[model samples]
Target: MKAFRQANHDLNSEPESAASILQSVKEQELQFEQLTRELEAERQSVANQLERCKLGSETAR
Candidate 1:
Protein backbone atom coordinates (compact mmCIF):
# COMPACT_ATOMS: atom_id res chain seq x y z
CA MET A 1 0.00 0.00 0.00
CA LYS A 2 2.84 2.44 0.83
CA ALA A 3 4.56 1.72 -2.47
CA PHE A 4 1.35 2.33 -4.35
CA ARG A 5 0.83 5.64 -2.59
CA GLN A 6 4.38 6.79 -3.37
CA ALA A 7 3.95 5.87 -7.01
CA ASN A 8 0.74 7.82 -7.18
CA HIS A 9 2.40 10.89 -5.70
CA ASP A 10 5.28 10.71 -8.16
CA LEU A 11 2.93 10.42 -11.08
CA ASN A 12 1.00 13.47 -9.94
CA SER A 13 4.15 15.58 -9.70
CA GLU A 14 5.45 14.65 -13.13
CA PRO A 15 2.71 16.40 -15.10
CA GLU A 16 3.12 19.62 -13.11
CA SER A 17 6.86 19.58 -13.70
CA ALA A 18 6.38 18.96 -17.39
CA ALA A 19 3.94 21.86 -17.67
CA SER A 20 6.34 24.24 -15.96
CA ILE A 21 9.16 23.27 -18.30
CA LEU A 22 6.91 23.67 -21.34
CA GLN A 23 5.86 27.16 -20.25
CA SER A 24 9.46 28.25 -19.80
CA VAL A 25 10.43 27.00 -23.24
CA LYS A 26 7.52 28.89 -24.83
CA GLU A 27 8.50 32.15 -23.14
CA GLN A 28 12.11 31.83 -24.27
CA GLU A 29 11.04 31.15 -27.85
CA LEU A 30 8.89 34.26 -27.88
CA GLN A 31 11.72 36.37 -26.54
CA PHE A 32 14.09 34.98 -29.16
CA GLU A 33 11.65 35.80 -31.98
CA GLN A 34 11.20 39.38 -30.80
CA LEU A 35 14.93 39.94 -30.59
CA THR A 36 15.37 38.54 -34.08
CA ARG A 37 12.85 41.03 -35.51
CA GLU A 38 14.47 43.99 -33.80
CA LEU A 39 17.90 42.99 -35.08
CA GLU A 40 16.60 42.76 -38.63
CA ALA A 41 15.07 46.21 -38.45
CA GLU A 42 18.33 47.71 -37.19
CA ARG A 43 20.29 46.01 -39.95
CA GLN A 44 17.98 47.46 -42.60
CA SER A 45 18.37 50.93 -41.16
CA VAL A 46 22.14 50.68 -41.30
CA ALA A 47 22.05 49.50 -44.89
CA ASN A 48 19.82 52.42 -45.89
CA GLN A 49 22.18 54.91 -44.30
CA LEU A 50 25.18 53.45 -46.12
CA GLU A 51 23.36 53.68 -49.44
CA ARG A 52 22.45 57.30 -48.86
CA CYS A 53 26.06 58.16 -48.08
CA LYS A 54 27.27 56.40 -51.21
CA LEU A 55 24.79 58.28 -53.39
CA GLY A 56 25.74 61.66 -51.88
CA SER A 57 29.44 61.08 -52.51
CA GLU A 58 28.81 60.13 -56.16
CA THR A 59 26.77 63.29 -56.70
CA ALA A 60 29.60 65.45 -55.30
CA ARG A 61 32.19 63.77 -57.56
Candidate 2:
Protein backbone atom coordinates (compact mmCIF):
# COMPACT_ATOMS: atom_id res chain seq x y z
CA MET A 1 0.00 0.00 0.00
CA LYS A 2 2.82 2.43 0.85
CA ALA A 3 4.56 1.68 -2.42
CA PHE A 4 1.34 2.28 -4.31
CA ARG A 5 0.85 5.64 -2.63
CA GLN A 6 4.42 6.66 -3.43
CA ALA A 7 3.97 5.72 -7.04
CA ASN A 8 0.77 7.72 -7.24
CA HIS A 9 2.47 10.75 -5.77
CA ASP A 10 5.27 10.48 -8.28
CA LEU A 11 2.84 10.25 -11.14
CA ASN A 12 1.00 13.34 -9.97
CA SER A 13 4.24 15.32 -9.68
CA GLU A 14 5.32 14.30 -13.16
CA PRO A 15 2.56 16.31 -14.86
CA GLU A 16 3.40 19.43 -12.87
CA SER A 17 7.06 19.09 -13.76
CA ALA A 18 6.18 18.64 -17.41
CA ALA A 19 3.92 21.71 -17.30
CA SER A 20 6.69 23.84 -15.80
CA ILE A 21 9.10 22.71 -18.47
CA LEU A 22 6.57 23.40 -21.21
CA GLN A 23 5.90 26.87 -19.82
CA SER A 24 9.60 27.68 -19.84
CA VAL A 25 9.89 26.53 -23.41
CA LYS A 26 6.96 28.72 -24.42
CA GLU A 27 8.47 31.74 -22.72
CA GLN A 28 11.77 31.16 -24.49
CA GLU A 29 9.99 30.93 -27.83
CA LEU A 30 8.24 34.23 -27.21
CA GLN A 31 11.51 35.90 -26.32
CA PHE A 32 13.08 34.56 -29.49
CA GLU A 33 10.18 35.85 -31.58
CA GLN A 34 10.46 39.31 -30.04
CA LEU A 35 14.19 39.39 -30.69
CA THR A 36 13.66 38.37 -34.30
CA ARG A 37 11.19 41.21 -34.80
CA GLU A 38 13.56 43.75 -33.31
CA LEU A 39 16.38 42.53 -35.52
CA GLU A 40 14.22 42.81 -38.65
CA ALA A 41 13.20 46.34 -37.73
CA GLU A 42 16.83 47.29 -37.26
CA ARG A 43 17.73 45.77 -40.61
CA GLN A 44 14.98 47.74 -42.35
CA SER A 45 16.09 50.99 -40.78
CA VAL A 46 19.65 50.40 -41.92
CA ALA A 47 18.53 49.64 -45.46
CA ASN A 48 16.51 52.84 -45.59
CA GLN A 49 19.48 54.85 -44.40
CA LEU A 50 21.70 53.27 -47.02
CA GLU A 51 19.24 54.14 -49.75
CA ARG A 52 19.07 57.74 -48.59
CA CYS A 53 22.85 57.98 -48.57
CA LYS A 54 23.03 56.59 -52.10
CA LEU A 55 20.48 59.12 -53.32
CA GLY A 56 22.30 62.00 -51.66
CA SER A 57 25.60 60.92 -53.26
CA GLU A 58 24.00 60.69 -56.70
CA THR A 59 22.51 64.18 -56.35
CA ALA A 60 25.86 65.61 -55.25
CA ARG A 61 27.62 64.02 -58.26
Candidate 3:
Protein backbone atom coordinates (compact mmCIF):
# COMPACT_ATOMS: atom_id res chain seq x y z
CA MET A 1 0.00 0.00 0.00
CA LYS A 2 2.84 2.40 0.75
CA ALA A 3 4.52 1.63 -2.56
CA PHE A 4 1.27 2.21 -4.40
CA ARG A 5 0.79 5.58 -2.74
CA GLN A 6 4.33 6.65 -3.57
CA ALA A 7 3.86 5.71 -7.21
CA ASN A 8 0.65 7.70 -7.38
CA HIS A 9 2.31 10.74 -5.86
CA ASP A 10 5.14 10.57 -8.31
CA LEU A 11 2.74 10.33 -11.20
CA ASN A 12 0.83 13.40 -10.02
CA SER A 13 3.98 15.46 -9.52
CA GLU A 14 5.33 14.77 -13.01
CA PRO A 15 3.18 17.45 -14.61
CA GLU A 16 4.17 20.04 -12.05
CA SER A 17 7.82 19.25 -12.54
CA ALA A 18 7.44 19.57 -16.29
CA ALA A 19 5.68 22.91 -15.89
CA SER A 20 8.44 24.28 -13.67
CA ILE A 21 11.09 23.26 -16.17
CA LEU A 22 9.13 24.88 -18.99
CA GLN A 23 8.95 28.16 -17.13
CA SER A 24 12.69 28.13 -16.49
CA VAL A 25 13.40 27.53 -20.17
CA LYS A 26 11.14 30.41 -21.18
CA GLU A 27 12.90 32.79 -18.80
CA GLN A 28 16.29 31.69 -20.13
CA GLU A 29 15.17 32.29 -23.71
CA LEU A 30 14.10 35.83 -22.90
CA GLN A 31 17.42 36.53 -21.19
CA PHE A 32 19.30 35.10 -24.19
CA GLU A 33 17.35 37.36 -26.58
CA GLN A 34 18.09 40.46 -24.54
CA LEU A 35 21.79 39.60 -24.38
CA THR A 36 21.90 39.06 -28.15
CA ARG A 37 20.42 42.48 -28.77
CA GLU A 38 22.87 44.15 -26.41
CA LEU A 39 25.81 42.37 -28.05
CA GLU A 40 24.73 43.54 -31.50
CA ALA A 41 24.46 47.12 -30.31
CA GLU A 42 27.93 46.97 -28.77
CA ARG A 43 29.36 45.50 -31.99
CA GLN A 44 27.84 48.28 -34.06
CA SER A 45 29.25 50.92 -31.76
CA VAL A 46 32.74 49.44 -32.02
CA ALA A 47 32.53 49.34 -35.80
CA ASN A 48 31.53 52.97 -35.94
CA GLN A 49 34.47 53.94 -33.71
CA LEU A 50 36.89 52.01 -35.91
CA GLU A 51 35.57 53.75 -39.01
CA ARG A 52 36.07 57.14 -37.41
CA CYS A 53 39.63 56.26 -36.43
CA LYS A 54 40.43 55.13 -39.97
CA LEU A 55 39.03 58.33 -41.45
CA GLY A 56 41.02 60.41 -38.98
CA SER A 57 44.25 58.66 -39.94
CA GLU A 58 43.57 59.18 -43.66
CA THR A 59 42.86 62.86 -43.18
CA ALA A 60 46.01 63.35 -41.07
CA ARG A 61 48.15 61.67 -43.79
Candidate 1's TM-score reads: 0.72
> lDDT per residue, candidate 2, 1-61, as tens digits?
9999999998887666768999999999999999999999999999999999999999999
Give the backbone clash total of model 2.
Answer: 0
Model 3 pairs in collision: none
| Tens digits of per-residue lDDT for model 3, 1-61 | 9999999998887656768999999999999999999999999999999999999999999
- Deviation in angstroms for 41 in model 1? 0.2
lDDT of each: 0.95, 0.95, 0.95
Q: Model 1's lDDT to the true fold?
A: 0.95
Cα RMSDs, all models: 5.5, 5.8, 4.4
Model number with the top TM-score? 2
Q: lDDT score of model 3?
A: 0.95
TM, every model: 0.72, 0.73, 0.72
Clashes of each: 0, 0, 0
Error of 2 at 45 (Å): 0.3
